[model samples]
Target: MRVVLQRVSKASVTVDGAVVGEIGAGLLLLVGIGQEDEEKDLAWMADKVAGLRIFEDGDGKMNLSVEDVGGAVLSVSQFTLYGDCRKGRRPNFMAAARPEQASDLYDRFNALLRAKGLTVATGTFGAMMEVSLVNDGPVTLILDSPA
Candidate 1:
């Protein structure tokens, strides 16, 4: 499993020129599921993201978790995170999970985030989505489950 986390002042997703999911003052999450990913991978990634202390605290230090700020989350399925571009000119997606497995894991991942007591918004799985966001501090991070 892999996830690209972007802290944003606001974020939204659009499909077919219609706005779908949106969030204010939160994180924009681009999630990817590997071929071997399972519930355990989902659990680990969700827990790590929930407790990540990237938000600033009272002293202006990055010590607050998203949960502490009561912020929301915009989770989008992005199998491209698993794209292997190390060799050829074209990226290879063989490491990405099939749509059926990926979609199931993606839904489970969002559910896990919601269970953490955060407001979770999501883009339609397998849809062609246009995502927009105002990146807070432009703070972004990548997470990957152990292989």
Candidate 2:
């Protein structure tokens, strides 16, 4: 599993010109499921995302987790994170999980985040979504589950 996490002042997802999911002062997550990803991967990622100390504390130090700051999460399914573009003009998605498996894992991952006591908003799985965000501190990080 792979996730591109961006700290945002606000974020929202639009599908077919309609807002599907939105959040204020939170993290925008572009999540990808690999073919080999399983429950363990989901658990690991959820824990990491929920506890990552990227938000700044009172002293202006990066010491606060999203949970500590009372921020929500905007999780979006993005299989393109697994795209392999090493040798061709077109990106190859062979490493991405099939939709059925990916969808199941994606849902489970969000559920895990919610179980962590964090408010989680999500875009429609498999839908063409337009995501907008105001990146806080422009802080972004890429997280991958242990192999």
Best by TM-score: 2
Off by over 4 Å in 2: none
Cα deviation of 111 in candidate 2 (Å)?
0.2
lDDT of each: 0.95, 0.98
Residue range 1-147, candidate 2, lDDT tens digits: 999999999999999999999999989999999999999999999999999999999999999999999999999999999999998699999999999999999999999999999999999999999999999999999999996
Model 2: per-residue Cα lDDT at residue 20: 94
Q: Which candidate is the best by lDDT?
A: 2
- Output candidate 2 Cα RMSD: 0.4
Candidate 1 clash pair list: none
Q: What ranges in model 1 sit over 4 Å off?
A: none
